[model samples]
Target: MTELDSTAFELLGSTGPFAELVSGFNVREPQLRMAAAVEQAIDAREQLVVEAGTGTGKTYAYLVPVLHSGKRAILSTGTRHLQDQLFHSDLPRVCEALGVQPKLALLKGRSNYLCLHRLQLTLEEGRFARRRQAAEVQAINDWSGRTRTGDVSELSDVPEDAPVWPRVTSTADNCLGSDCPSYRDCFVLKARRRAQEAEVVVVNHHLLSADMALKEEGFGELLPGAEVVVIDEAHQLPETAAQFFGLSLGSRQLQQLARDAKAEHLREAGDMQNLPDSADALDKAAADLRLAFGQGNRRLPWKDIRHKPEVESALADLRSVLEQLRTWLETAAPRGKGLEGCWHRAEQLAHKLARVCAEADGEYVQWLETYTRSFAIHLTPLNVAGIFQQQLARLPATWVFTSATLAVGQDFHHFTGQLGLHEPHTLQLESPFDFQSNSLLYVPPALPEPNSPSYTGAVMDHAEHLIEASGGRAFLLFTSHRALQAAADRLQESEYPVLVQGQMPKRELLRRFRELGNAVLLGTSSFWEGVDVRGEALSLVLIDKLPFAAPGDPVVQARIDRLREAGGNPFMEFQVPGAVITLKQGVGRLIRDAADRGVLVLCDPRLLNKPYGRVFRRSLPPMPLTRELREVEAFFAAGMTDKGEQARA
Candidate 1:
């Protein structure tokens, strides 16, 4: 490997190569320092964790080193938006600046690509029951005919959650693979092949987790040949990894399996008796299982549901139906390859469901979640750190995990411990922006505690004054949907436009918030992070409470129970640091750019009364902290006055 000189690192800093390549580029010390750290980690083949504050240009910082190193690397991001941005915009710009041409491929999960076989089957069967569904199918068909990539995102007219999408896309359980007539033109296969041959592959966290677990479609792997893996938005990795390592079986999956089995049997099983009846029976059993859950959407532990006679009976009947279906499929196995695949899927599903239902060992937590029309059973491990550590140990490569919020109060223990990375190289680079001058952390005095009955009203009253001060250019973030709605209702009387989260989609709401320029958006956890709006349009961020995961959540409860059993302090070890990271994300949403300035309102009184509150205060950016309402008003007033003076001058 050729050693890159200091000048190469300098090129990434201010007044270097970026000044010539990027428009409106400013030299940032933190960005340069991060780039150097990444380059060193890559060169030395070391594990690195970095918490680069927002505006550090960490994307290009890591991209420059990874691309310039001439090593095949897997770049995994937390969202498809960032994946697309890196592949289409950031990677290309950095490669151009470095004067290097590397083969790059963007790969998403199988669901994002159109399956020609599924599309043809849906079209041939005329499965569209609604006019809107038919229109969406037609739109997808039209796009498929003209498109090369077969990416669903290319169809701008099609909403992502369209009901017709599931009918036209392939899942691992349903895909016929090389046995299908459309195998040669499979978009998913083509994308994976390209990714395999590329020097750099861009994927999301879910896809990376799927790869790590060897659960990728067609039993393929993407990480074997890569020399380095860079996981962006690393704070989300532990949760995503947990999901990948867990076992999940849903009613919808069973229904789909039954449908596919019956269809395949009909086409290939030459007069096989009782096959269709068995499939119908399996479908009925799935419906019965869903009904056994009673009403409403909820999650219940196995201990609570197993003792119920009705649930037990329903489970036994479901198991019997699955066994019968599996027997029929096995007896008719000589039909064709497609029928054989269906039989294998049914067998696997039956065994998995049986294991999940029967196993209540201490290592795993078994729970059931019921939706309005369907339900799911899951077996999630109490801890995934050990499993993830094993996976990392098996892969011989440099691992880099980075995010804007990964540390709490200069400590990386919570983040590192969750991933089981002991003694990895760590760096924390604060945002170079002048937070002291550009922001104010306002905690109003005399507010009730977060758990108090009057806390919602108190939060709304204070948020109303702050929103009025900033003229509705604010994001009123809440810790729960209930609080968000209450705030929305109380603020409805205001003259400015108010946009709540559930009224429309998040992207649309953000768009409207930006265009209105002075609209107040009320949202819960989703709005706290991965949202950016610059200039005077978003000058205030109001958080209702510290974002602690609800103790009622089954996963959270299970983890807490496990920690307590192990004689560990769950509250201090898990809850506090997690809330601190979340609060930091909420605050980070305010000052996205160097010139942006804003006021942050944290309405939770515990920040002052509780001793642990110091962790949250210390973790946040070093913005000017204040406890008075007039100080907030005066800050905005002075900003307006300065704008007026600049206009006149």
Candidate 2:
């Protein structure tokens, strides 16, 4: 390599496209330090952990170095939205200004693409004809002809929650891979091939997890081996890794098998007498479980049923029925091709059910839940750290994880320990924005305790007060659906327009919220992070609680027990750190740009009552603090006037 290529970053020296990008853009010291550190790390080929604060421009800090290095790299973001932004907006703009010619590809998982073969089968066999209307099929038919990417996102007219997509889509279990007749025109395979040759590939955490799991199964490589992998939103890694590692068998899987069997039986016009009998038995068991769960209104751990005869009886009956169905399917397997396929699917599902029945090992926790109208049995690992460590030990790539909230109070112990990454070179970069002048932390006084009977009402009142103070540009975040609904219902009674979570599709809601520029949105998980609303449009954020995982949650309980076994205090080790990281994400939503002004109202009084409150408080952005409610109103009022004057000028 030439000298220019060897030290191009140094020779370019602080005044190229990157510097120009920040010329009138107000380059803060912390962002520049992060950019330089990223450059050094790229040259050294070492692992690094960076906690880039809100408004740190961390995207550019790493992108500049990655682009300059001119090596094949993979950028894995936490969400599909960020993956889209990086591939379509950030990379193109930066590469154009720097005159870098690096091919890039946006690669999603198999499910995200349209499977033409599956689409043809669904239409030809009339499998989903009953669930979908004629107009919907016509819309999809029109879409299939014009789509190059085959991403469902292209069909903006179709709601994401629509049922039509699932019927025509393919899952890993059913995908025939290269055996399919349309392999030459397969969208997913084509995308993977392009990604293999591209210099930079943008993918989400789920896709990365898929690749990791696939590698373990001795499958062909799903992703190219890159010299470096940059992971954004690193805080979500532990929870997502746990999901990909654990196992679960839902009622939907059983229902899908039955439906598939019916479809096949109809297609071949074969006798499905025994198959329907097994399907009916499975359906009846599912209904009985649902009814029993409804009548009990109890959330019991797997072990708690030892004393309750009724609970034990119900579980025993369910298991017996499932085993009987499995036996019937096995007997019918040798009769015909249609029967064999159904039997195979049933057997695969039954293995998981049998594991649930056996309560296989202490590493797994068994629990039953009834939500909306359906019930499910979940078997989540007590600890994913052991599995994650094993997986990482098997890999040889240089992994670079970056997020705005990985480190808590300038320490990496909270995040790095959970992911089982020890002694990695850690870096903390503060937000580029001047938080002292641009942001205010509001902790309202005279509010009811979080556990008090009237807590939700008090929180709604405080939320209303804060939103009114900020002229209705606010996000009221809650830790529970009950709290979200309470806030939304109360807000709707008032003057401000309320954009609740399910009122509309997320994309359309966000778009309308931004367009309205002065609406209050009430949401839970999805709204806690990855939301960017800059300037005066979003001037307040009200968090209903500390965002601790619910106590009844099986996964949370399992993780807590695991922490205790390690001689660590579960409250301090698991709960406190998790809340702190999530609180950071919620508050981070307020101030997106340097010039933005907002008030972050944390309604939880436990933040002040408990000793661990200090940990949560100190992890927040370094905004000017205020306990007096009037101070918040005055600050936002003045901010509004100043913004108005600037707009007029």
Candidate 3:
């Protein structure tokens, strides 16, 4: 390995050229130390795990090194928001600061790009069922004529979860590849080509996993030639990797195949034969299978599903129709632009169904979820460590995994062990922010336990006091939707504007919260992490409970059982550390910048009562602790007075 050059190392320091080129660049020792570690990892071709706290400027720390290394690298983040920040914002500024321009590409999953063929088909078939749907389709069609990248993100007017998106965008199962009518101008293909040739590629964890698993077509492997792979929000990689490694077959996939088959038949003007009837039968069988789940949405283990006669009958019927459809598609030998894609989808779906129904393996936990209109069979691995280790072995690239929440009390074992990395170089950098004065960890005394019947009301009562003290600039984060709804109900008549999670999209809700400057936003899991709200707009973050996976969840139960069977302490080894990391993420949301000041309210008494409470305390930032609501009110009042003084000055 080549020795690290002083020139590259010097650039990270406060007096370096970076500081001169970038405006308002602060000289943070942690950021410089992290940058050095990243550079060394790349030069030595070894794995590195880093935990850089909230104000460490971890992004620029790693970006400077990766860009300076001049190596083909893949930078994967956990969310598209971060991906965009890196690709569109941070990368450009850092590259300019370094006076080097590297070829860069931002690639997302296939579904993020527009498929011209699918759009044309949707338009030709007049598939819009509502006025809004038609308008959305028309908007996309109009945008398609001018979008240079064809990224769905360009259509900010369209909601991310719009029903028309799936119809207009193509998935792996439905894409026709070179056989596509729009092959010459395919947005996904163009993006892939750019990524294959770029010096740096920015992608989300899911896309990176798909490429690592070789699940995506057209691109045989996404990271083969890259020299360094830096994963931001690396904590999410293990779960995302497990999801990609596992097999899932949803009713929607089957229905989409049937729809595509019918479309192909119509486009080809081919003999219908029994193709249409088979498609109808498959659709009906899928509907029957959904009905067999009875009512409401729930996930159940194979044991529970096996004993239900209705579910069993519906599964048998669905399996029969899928097999019949696959055979018909195979025998028909339909010659058309899209028929082959449909046939391939049918074959793959049939095989997946067979695999999902087979006897569960010891390493995997097989379960099924019944949604309102669709059902899916899932086979999630009990542990992803082994699978991830094998993938690492396959790709001999320098690996760097960094996240703010990867370590608990200065230990990276919980994070590294999940990814099968035994002893990679490890670094823990505390946030440079003066948390001792800027933040307060407030735990009100005499609160009801999280599981108590009166817990929600109690939490609301406390939260209302905190919000009122902070002048309604707070985030009321709940562990469950039930608690969130209950809190929303209790706070409905408050003087402050209440923004619930489902009332609008997450981004919109955040925008409103920031704009209102004194609104309370109630949300669940999605808001726990990857949410960035800085300044006086968010002064208090109230967590109703410790963020622990519900023990009743089939997957969680299976994992606990597996841990027990292996003779490990499930509570200490799995549950406590996991919850600690989650709590850390929730707390990290409050202090984003050096000037940001906020009060974090952890309503869960477990932090003070449980034997493992110390673990949670040690994992959080070193902030002053308080138990008195009056202290919280005093802190806010002091903060307001400070602001007033600054304004007068």
Residue by residue across 372-411, what tens digits does model 2's lDDT show?
5566667766766677767667654566889999977878
| Model 1 bad stretches (over 4 Å) | 1-8, 218-220, 265-274, 331-333
Q: What is the TM-score of each candidate against the true structure?
A: 0.96, 0.90, 0.97
List the candidates ranked by lDDT, beginning with the highest: 3, 1, 2
Poorly placed runs, candidate 3 (over 4 Å): 1-8, 217-219
> Which regions of candidate 2 deviate over 4 angstroms?
1-14, 19-28, 125-133, 214-224, 269-273, 280-284, 295-300, 304-341, 647-649
lDDT of candidate 1?
Answer: 0.87
- Clash counts per candidate, in order, are 1, 0, 0
- Tens-digit per-residue lDDT, 553-616, candidate 3: 8888999999998999998999988998888988888989999998999988988998789999
- Residue 7 shift from truth in candidate 2, angstroms: 5.6
How many clashing pairs in candidate 3? Answer: 0
lDDT (Cα atoms) of all candidates against the true structure: 0.87, 0.74, 0.87
Which candidate leads the pack in TM-score?
Answer: 3
lDDT of 1 at 188: 92
- Residue-level error in angstroms, candidate 2, position 621: 1.6
Better of 2 and 3 by TM-score: 3
1-649: candidate 1 lDDT, tens digit per residue: 2223544468776557788879998887788788888888888899999999999989987988898789999999998978998899999898898898989999999999999977876776574578899989998998998999999989989988787888889887788888877899999999999998899999998888877775655324668788989999999999888877888899988887787777676667849868878888989999998888899888878777876898899999999988998898988878877678778889889988988888678888888899998999888887778988998888878899999999988999999999999799999999999998989999989987788999999888888889889988999899988888888889878999999998987888988999999999888877888788988889999988889998988888999998998999999999999899889888888999999989998888888889998989889888888998999999999999999999999
Clashes of 1: 1
CA RMSD of all predictions: 2.1, 3.5, 1.7
